[model samples]
Target: MTVIDAVRGDLAEVRAEVDATLDRFLAGKAGTAPDPCLPPLVEVLRGFVAGGKRLRPLFCHCGFLAAGGSPDDRAVVWTGAALEMFHTFALVHDDIMDRSAMRRGRPTVHRLLAEHFAGSREDDGVAAERFGMNLAILVGDMCFAWTDELLDRVEVDPPRWREVRALLHTMRTELIAGQYLDLGGDPRSTADPVRSAWRMTRLKTARYTVDLPLRIGAALAGGDAALMRACGAYGRPVGEAFQLRDDLLGVFGDPGVTGKPDLDDLRAGKPTVLMALARQQATPEQREVISALHGDPDLDEERAERLRDVVVATGAAERVERLITIRAERALSALRSSSMAPAAKASLSDLVAHATRRAR
Candidate 1:
């Protein structure tokens, strides 16, 4: 089997076991638990974690293997679990912050919780939204709490935990900062969409999605500075490619498969690399249409399809695709030269390919 095939096998086992552990953790909690009611938190976490691709955990495990740590080791499993919990927490908070409606073909935590609240005797919209957001925020906090608790179970030295902690904190901060930057929509940078898109992609998605997971995994496996640096070099480009692929999907992917509204990115005025390129290359009249329709919530299918035509006719999608291909190639080159184990390199290569080529 290929490295990914093997990793998926191991990943299946880890996911089930980790889920059971989370369930147990929730069940064992006292009614008088120090924090808010544990049941809601547990339910939200379990729901959020369901049906995920488990990409972050795979990265963590791959890093361990790359650093010469055995998959059979208990520490590797715990490391992966900790990182997965961290991801769960991040997603809960992210959905709340973004006011997103769905994830992985299901209602997001906030929406789910809000619907549940609305069903109660008090069915006010404002109240439901507030309750849902508050509950989700706390649920996210609870997940974060569990992540740290899982990490503490690792028998690694305090110094090692410190290093991992710093990396985690840095990743979280960067993701939040990226979200803010994206929301602010600074006009000066919008003048040059390619550079702006690259910047946003790197900060908003790449760093947290790819780099931190590998770096933390390597650190936990006692990888040295040079090896860690190599992993970072490998991850960032692959992460960018991953987001670029996501951009492609956002514009062109089937809603049934992608589980998102079509052209939602355009509606959000996301300033993606593809959109920027289209803007840069469009005729004056085409530019006017794009500018007027970019973020219009009332944009209909006819308009959206026309905009898609413009994006393709202008060659922006092709250019972004080229960029994705180039970055994927560079990422592979870096992975090959890194001081990681052969199996680890193979796994990373598979991950890079999967990230770049995913249809949804």
Candidate 2:
């Protein structure tokens, strides 16, 4: 079943509310563009924002409820909206860096922009790829600005807002730090490659995707230190499992089902723990296969098939799967021991599957 079908009533309510908030916000943005050229840009941003699973917002609401906040509170709802907008900014820039061709089963924003600008700049000799990259960067910046504006609209008291902003500042900082690690852009990255990959997963994927969002919601609800600590206990492992599963999917998932190419991460030689494990376990022959095909810009379906075989042959894929299961269990164990409301606990339990096992 789809996530909407699988989740119970109240969770579905927030999903609908968050979607409405985004639609209304972006629609108004489209109409209010100061320049004629800007409206279409706004529309593109709107379309991009419309495609995600709203995982961040859902997690945020779960945290709020867990912290004893009322379900009727619109402040948490708007905060969820802000989270989704920030996610948009992250995604656009990520695609550019990964040189991804598609997202949500469609051409990525940069590629679309490249095509859009190609004709206009045909005679000026500006390369389409460069122009597209430049414009998409601006679009990402716009989302960054919009995220702050959305947060500004939430009617929370100054103290609560201050706490939330501090959490956001930390989240944003770690997000950039994690990205640099992934890009080998950090000087402090460990020399041990597997440990480095794990660090990147912790900083970039796990914390960004799940941990801080949960805490942000909890903080908004005035959750105390113990409650926020509980949020971390459940969130950190679940988030790690979530990203580990994504690593598997990126290499093995069906593009038709995933709505994303399986080849990109493999092509980028993303320094995932999965790859680290595979390399360590590989025989010399298998090692040669990896060195030959992985990270090759021209890697094709036939070669990717060989690399997939090597990963499975080395037992790396199986090992990663085991890690995901272990991490998920850790999360569930943490949940069972928490003092969260039963409704909050149950909703979070339901979401673990979404976090770790969704096809897309």
Candidate 3:
């Protein structure tokens, strides 16, 4: 089997463990006469978990294996599961903050809750919408709580925990900082595409998505500082490439495969590398079109496609694709230089290639 297949196998195992732990936790609460909304909240959690590919857990497992860990050791799986739980926590909050309506093709937690409230109300829909959002906020909090609980239950050594803690803290803090930067937009914002994109990509995507998980897994396996550093070096570039691919998908991907509308990022004015580049190079007419339509929630698919055409015609797509290629190469080079076993090196290389080249 290929490395991706192996990674998927490991991710499935970790996901199952997380599922059982969450079920048991919910059951305990149920037995104690939990809130009426708690059952629905758990149902939302299940939906959220089901929607993901568990990429974080897969990275964690791969890092553990690269650090000389055995597949049979259950701690590796538990550690991987902890990363997935943390990722779920982040996504739940992100969707709320983004005011997103969908995730992985299903209604977002807040949106779903709002819909439920709307159906039950006799009066106008506004009050119901507000109530549903409130409940979703609470349910998302519960998911975050469960993430912490999962981490607390892991049986890794104290030193390993410390290492994982450091990475987790960095990942969480950096992502929030990136989110703040993203939300706090400026007409006068620093307009350097490379600088802005790097800042956003590193904190918002790279460190959290790839580096931290790899470090956590490797550290848990008692990998040396050199090896851990190598993982970070390797992961950063791969993560950036992965996000670049995601940015492309956000604009140009197939809705059926991506589980999100194409060009949704353009409508959201996500400040992605593509957008930054487009802004840098667009003609006055092109800029006008972008400014008029970007982040406009009312923008229909036809208008969104027009904006996408502008981005492509302006060569932003080409620029971003070049960067993706560069990052992918760097990731491969990092793996080659690392001291990991040959099989592990092959696995990581395959992962980097797959992530960078995927259509969605």
Candidate 4:
């Protein structure tokens, strides 16, 4: 098989292994739940986690192998599964904050919970919505706790474990801080929207999604500072490219393929680099249109299309495409220069392509 094919096969196997680990872990939690009602929450988490690409776990596994750790090590798998659990927690909270109705082509956790509780309330819609948000918040907190529980079970020497714990803590803090920025904190209020967007992307996605996972895995395998630094060099740029591609897909991708409404980002006024660029480069007339149409709760398809046209006409989309290429190249360069295992290098190279160029 080609290197890319081999990497794909290995990633599929890792995904299955991580899924099995998560299934077994959650089953145990469900079986031992303090309250019978908690089992359903575990069930919801299980369902929500089942449909992801499992990219974080795959990257962690690659990092482990890159640092000379055994591919068959169960500790590596457990750590990777912990990362996935943390990701689920983040997504659940994100959906609530965004007021997103759909995730993974179904009602979001909050929406699903709201609908489930609808029958018990006199003011069914309003009360159910409140119930859903509250319960979903608790569910997200549970997932966060479970992630730490899973990580705690992984066997490593004391120093390595300490390093791993530090990385994990840093990752969580960076993600939460990034989310705050995304939710219109001080960073979002900056005059230079593009710079603010990039800063948020680095904190929210680059470190959390790629850099920390790789470094954490490497640390677990006792990799030194230099190797961990190399991982950051490679991972951060690729991670940024991944998020940039996601921003593009949010605005321009087919809903059937993306499993998300294309209009959601526009309506939510997400401060993406693409939008920032469009705003910066727009003509006065286009800016007026953006001001009137963007973030409108009742924004229709026609106006969204016009907004899209403005983005495209301003060349922001093409500029983002160029940026993706630049970052992917930077990642590839780092991979080539590093002394990681050849197989790991090949897998990471494939990952850069997959992460940056995917349609969904």
Candidate 5:
């Protein structure tokens, strides 16, 4: 079989294994829970986790193989599951912060909880919202705790385990720092929107989503510093490209296809690279239109369309596409020079394409 084909086949299998592992783990937790409320939380988390692309776990799997770890080692799979759990925690908190109503095409955790309590005696609308946010926060915290528990179960040797744990610690710290930056305010309002957006992307998405996952997996396999560096070299550019593509999708993608409203980003005043670029390039009249309409809570389809047109007219969307191309090429170049297994390299190449080219 071609290397790419072999990697594809392995990835499909790994994905299945990861899914099963997650199911079994969550089921076990639910079965042993002491409190009745814990069962419901576990169930909600299971549902939330079921709908993702499993990108982090897949990357970890690829990294494990790249570093000469046995594909048959189930410890790697459990580690990937731990990463996914952490991701769930991040998403739950992110949704709360954004006041997002939908995720993976369903009511968000907070929204689900809000609706559950809508008709209760204490269900003033605002109170219901507050209650939902509070509950979701606790749920997110539980998921974070679960991540450490899952990692603790993975049976690596002491030396490799220490390395992996350190990577995990760094990943968690960087993610929190990035999230804090993201919560600071809208990028458009910042003095240097591009710089702010880029920093936030690197922290919030790139490192957590790509760099550290690969590093952690490599560490678990006792990969040397050179291999870890190669992973970082390939991961950062591709990860940034992934986020840039997401930025484009947030403004231009079909909600039905993306499984979330396109208007959410604009409504939230998200400080994406696309928006930052548009802000930089817009004419005076265009700037006024953007400032007035971009973050309006009641932003309607008509105004959104106008904002999109302005973004397009400024050529920011095209610029981002070009950026994706550039970054993808850089990742490929790094992969070619790395001393990874041929299969791993082929798989990473495929991932680079997938990450940068997806409709959603």
Candidate 6:
């Protein structure tokens, strides 16, 4: 089976249920809104939420199952919905910060908002864009607020709920700190960019995206410390591999398949491990190309292609491919050796492939 195919059917089941739960919750939210104007925003949110791969929630469910929680438990599903809401908050805000114009093959939330404002009001272009940014921020804040609402509805044990909350809090803090470091560019001449980039990857994606989500699910099931430790074993390497592959994809993936503009990561000069590796291995001429064009805000497709060549020439892409392989192997080894049930271990093993190799 294809690597992603392993997770496809099983994950689809979790996805459908979680999607239904979110739909019902958001519909209820819209129906009970304090103001007429609020319903429209919720509709927009539903649209935005619909297109996600739901990887976090799937991992959450997997953790629940891994901890011997019953698949029939509504709490796990509801809590997964809550995590999805939180993810929406992150993505919306992330797009704003990235100045991304497209998401999930559609106009980004903030950009859509800007166009809406521009169409409705006789405002200058800058005013409409500013309005869009402000409104999108509010929308992200609302998603954060709704996460509490979703979690409130889930009836887990008090002690377990506390643990889950702690995990979520840590995830958010790490994500924000990582994002701040991300926004602070790593100049080509930085003393130790590879180390910085790896730290950022672990904080922003590894712990936040995988480790905590798995632990959160396990927590809801009252999993013991041993189970939590096992989840970390499978989670950390897989999450880092996931981000490292994503870094490669960002620079080298087809925009048509990935549904993201290829230029953004390069244009932003994201100090990803992939980039740091390239900077380290580059010849002086190749280093010159990266320095002059890597972070240019107005970088075009052709220049982006040239940078891709530099990465390949420096062997950074091949080295990153090796990194992904090692991490995936470590994650799977952890899964195989963990005390988690065989069925759960199998599913997580599948995830190693999906997280590390997905096109989008």
How well does each candidate superpose onto the true structure, as a TM-score? 0.90, 0.96, 0.90, 0.97, 0.95, 0.96
* lDDT string, candidate 3, 269-355, tens digits: 787777878888999999899899888878898898899899899999998899899998998988888898676687677678778
What is the clash count for each candidate, in the order shown? 0, 0, 0, 0, 0, 0
Off by more than 4 A, model 6: 1-8, 185-189
Per-residue lDDT of candidate 6, residues 104-194 (tens digit):
8788899988986688888899999989998899999999999988999889878999999999889888889888778865354267889
Residue pairs whose backbone atoms clash in candidate 1: none
Over the stretch 92-111, how does candidate 2's per-residue lDDT look in tens digits?
Answer: 99999998999988889998
Scanning candidate 3 in windows of ten residues, the lowest lDDT window is 1-10
Candidate 6 residue 65 C-alpha distance from true site, Å: 0.9
Superposed model 2: Cα runs more than 4 Å off: 1-5, 123-126, 187-190
- Which of 4 and 5 is the better model by lDDT? 4
TM-score of candidate 6 to 2 decimals? 0.96
The better-scoring model by lDDT among 3 and 4 is 4
**In terms of lDDT, which candidate is stronger, 1 or 4?**
4
lDDT of 5 at 25: 93
- Compose the digit string of candidate 1's lDDT tens values, residues 98-198: 67787777888888888876787466898899898998898888778878788777777777778888988887788777776666456768567678777
Please give the lDDT score at residue 1 for candidate 1: 18
User: What TM-score quantifies how close candidate 1 is to the native fold?
Assistant: 0.90
Give candidate 2's root-mean-square deviation (CA, Å).
Answer: 1.6
Clashing pairs in 6: none
